[model samples]
Target: MNSLLITSTEESTGKTAIALALATLASAQGASVGYMKPKGTRLQSNVGKILDEDPMLARDLLDSTDDLAEMEPVIYSPTFIENAIRGQEDPDALRDRVAENFAHLATDRDLMVVEGGGSYTTGGIIGLTDADVANVLDSKVLLVATYREPGDVDDVLAAAESFGDRLGGVLFNAVKDADYDRVSTDVVPFLESRGIPVYGVLPRKRELAGLTVSALAKELGAQLVTPNVPTDGYIERFVVGAMGAEAALSQFRRTKAAAMITGGDRTDIQTAALEAPGITCLLLTGGFQPPGAVVGKAAERGVPILLMQTDTMTTIERAEDVIRSGRTRDEETVASMRELLAAHADVDAILQ
Candidate 1:
């Protein structure tokens, strides 16, 4: 059976989303696809059973019946690092365990898609890093990297150096619009010349990065002030209305869909956000409720008002953390991801 390991240069590079998309695409082509996350981070509790979120998402999306625990061989527990440092955890045994799980999961499968931990070198302390585990599983690496600046190409090259011949290709993800041209023009050629194929270049998609208003409100513990507002819509960016009302309006107008976060006391900024065409919702800080007129206007415009006790800085940070934490639990996101890949990515080459 063929094995493709999806890993990243660092955390939150969208490895799970790309892996699920490519796997879904391959499965559509009539191949038996198996999934695994050798070292499960981003722990969660499902049905009173503790497991990683990525594997659970993959399992549900791929419709695999394999046991979750078996699919994710290693769960990063509270004291996992402490135990590893104290020499209580055996490296060779853990390696064997992961390999054994891969073998079992690979049964009668045409391809196995393994997701590594946070980054390529995530498990270096325990000898379970992506390179280490790939060596044991004999899998080729599909490196998903984010290029905020051109210098990031060096980061990809550095990671590729470690994988050497086993590097299947690189997928430049979440690339900014400004940097996409250089990545497609100069960077792709350099990498391909070095024997590493460039499978895809996906610009940052707000839909893929966005969190629903309802989900954001729930996660932030904010109170919904407006009645019967649509909270199911997604908000891509959360802009802090720290500047003057005029400046804030200009910024808010730029985003196609975003939540304007400001102090509840900043009535000017609040009013401006309400008038802006792109403001999907308003996150008011300091637990202060908006005036009846503001509330009426928000309700009239169908914008949700989420009130929270946390200050502006804290709320902005929390919202960012939520956006950075990607998701594939919803069908809309799944469908859009496939569309993005089909248009921009070489799904056939990568899976082939």
Candidate 2:
């Protein structure tokens, strides 16, 4: 069974999303493909029953399973890593475990996609990171480069050099039309001269992010507040704690606005937000029993309430990743990202 590890030099570089897209495209081409997020922080569980966090999305996009635990492992807290290293737990041990799982999954499959952690050089001291794990699995890497500027090229080259002979190729992702022109015109030529193979430069589209949100809402059975809201007007800045609500609200008022996600139990916060005009929707973080009064207040005021089982911190982190990496424009976004990965991923080359 042959496999390739998809990694990036930083978080929100479209690593998981790109891997899923690749799997989907490859599958459409009639290649038997399977995907897995080797190491992750959050696990999807519901009312004593475990659920695949993004099961439907995974299946719909990549045509994979939600029942497979190895598909995504929850490894969020710092304590988890500490324990894994001290042998109190084997959190990072996912490298080989996922490898075996992929080898098994690849029995009749054409290609196995192993998605990496935050970045290739991300393992903490005293433990193996994604790069080390890739080495252990002896899999070549497919880098997801997400960038918006010229520095992106340097970063991608950096990662490529760090991975050395393990570099399979590069995927310039989330690019805009203009950026793609600059890259394939100037940047790509330079890299090619240095012996790098730019596998594919994918364009940036709102469809990708929209697909994630829509799938999440369907999986959680959460309702959309404003279905007609333009993707461009969607809220980009997210505030987690109530302490920042005032600023968040003020910012939303300036923009066309989309949704305001909060906690169902946060009546005080909800009421305060209700009093404010110019807001679109409200998302309650925790899955708690909503009181009739709160529901009445929200409905009467025409505010949409989205309820998510995940806590505030987890929700915030997830939302941030989606927003930061969710720019929906054109080809330049992809080219810029690829260039960035090429620069920063050169850990070994830089050290030398």
Candidate 3:
């Protein structure tokens, strides 16, 4: 069976998001697509609740429940590489386990999209780094490098130079709107001249950023209070509370949003928000347990309250963190992803 691995040069660069985008494009072309996240981390709080595992996200977006292990078996932790190197664990066993999972996924699927953990330069002690998985699966690598500053292009080129033939192409993500023309005109030529295909230069559009509210809650290693929150349409804008109750309430009041995000423990803020007019959705951050009163009020008002365990600061940080990384429907770069899937024509071909 053939599989393609999507990876990045660093964390939070939208690896899983890009994988899903590719799946969206492939499914459009009639490919029976399968997805896998070889290393699952940042697990959910509830027992047996798997979260931030790339395979699960891939399967959910693809609308299928393939076996979790087969889709991805070797989950990674901070000490994974350390333990493996000390001979406390077996890398080959982990490899075999994931391979078995892959075999199952490959049986019924025409194309399987495998996502990597962290940057391509990353490797855990248990023997599953981006390179290890790439070598084992014999899959071509599509590197996602986010452009945050002037030297970002050099990093991508260096990664390509480092990986050499294993590198299939690179996609420049999270690019500023002003630099789009410059990147396409100036940067694209240099990269192409060096024989590295600038697959596409994606503008720093918010909509194309990865994971909506519900998805963020899942990834934050928190409990999911509202499973199916509306994330498909346009999110008007986001407002975060930095000061205490007065500041939060005042800021929240200014927003006429489809959704409002705040700390779960901020009862004063929550109470005010519950009583306030014109908010359809409430996102409680830092996993704060909502007061009974707030919960009851929200229910009566028919407002959806998402209780995520990430702390107020961390939650807001995470939200704002990925805001620039979110995906949208209006960008030309998205069109490029669609185009690549169409050009490939076969999942098996890319996998091979």
Candidate 4:
């Protein structure tokens, strides 16, 4: 079976998202697509069984028949490193297990998409880095780079150099509107000149990147104050209301589908956010509940109000964590991602 190793320069570059899109496209073209994450770092406990979240998500997205344990194979829990240091886990044996599981999973498949854990250096502790795994599996590398700034090109090039001819290409994702032209003209050509293929340069779509209100509430461990709001509705941007109500309103107005983060006592700011356009939800920090009138207004507007005990900074940090690790599971986000990839990415080149 032909295998493609999907990895990234850093974490949260949408490695799984790109993998799912590619697998979807490949399946549409009649290829039997299989996916596996050799070493799972985002350890999850599914009813006492340890598994990785990415493989679970991929299994559902691809409608694969493989069991979760088979799909992930190697899970690194909080105690894994400690056990390894104490000689409880054998690195060579682990490698063999990963290889065995991969071979079994790839059986009868036309193409297998192997997702690397986190960055290229992620699994070095267990000797299963992205390049190492790719070499072991005899698969080509397709690096997914999240366009943060001009310096990202250098990072991608360095990765390409590390992969050498094993690197199939780079997919530039989450390119902001301001940097689209530069990425298409300068970044793409520079990478190609260095012998790296540019398969796709995808623009940033807030709908695909944002976290839903339900996800935010779960992450913040907050109590929902407003009832019956659409938990699946997403917030594209975050507006922290630390300033005066008037100033905060201006900042909130600039963002579409924003989750307004403010102190619970800031009734002025909370009211202003409710009045603003594209206000998906209100995250009230400091454990203080908004006035009854404010809650009534939010309830009337069908907005979800999450009340948290944490301070503003801590809440913002947690929200960032949620957004960074959030996946495109909802139908709308999945469809949007597939459409974006189909339009921008060279599916024919990717499949081959």
Best by lDDT: 1
Candidate 2, residues 137-184, lDDT tens digits: the string is: 677778777658999888989988887888877777667777878876
TM-score between candidate 4 and the true structure: 0.86
In model 1, the worst 10-residue window by lDDT is 325-334
Clashing pairs in 1: none
lDDT of 4: 0.84
- Per-model clash counts, in order, read 0, 48, 20, 0
RMSD of each: 3.0, 8.2, 7.1, 3.1
Q: Candidate 3, residues 86-111: lDDT per residue as tens digits?
A: 78888788888877777777777777
Alpha-carbon deviation at 209 in model 2, angstroms: 4.2
* lDDT comparison, 1 vs 3, better candidate: 1
The per-model lDDT (C-alpha) reads 0.86, 0.60, 0.66, 0.84
The sequence of per-residue lDDT tens digits that candidate 1 reaches over residues 1-352 is 8999999999888788888887888899999999999888877678887788878878888898998889998876757878988988988999999999999999999999999888898888789889998899999899999988778888998899888888989998888788889999999999899888988899888767677888888877889999689998788777889999899889888886788999999889999998888899999999898998899889899999999999989988878877766643465666777888899988887887
Candidate 3 has its poorest 10 consecutive residues by lDDT at 324-333
Least accurate stretch of 10 residues (summed lDDT) in model 4? 325-334
Q: RMSD of model 4, in Å?
A: 3.1
> Model 2 residue 256 lDDT?
30
**Which has the better TM-score: candidate 1, or candidate 2?**
1
Model 4 stretches astray by more than 4 angstroms: 85-88, 218-221, 228-233, 237-257, 262-280, 296-303, 309-317, 328-332
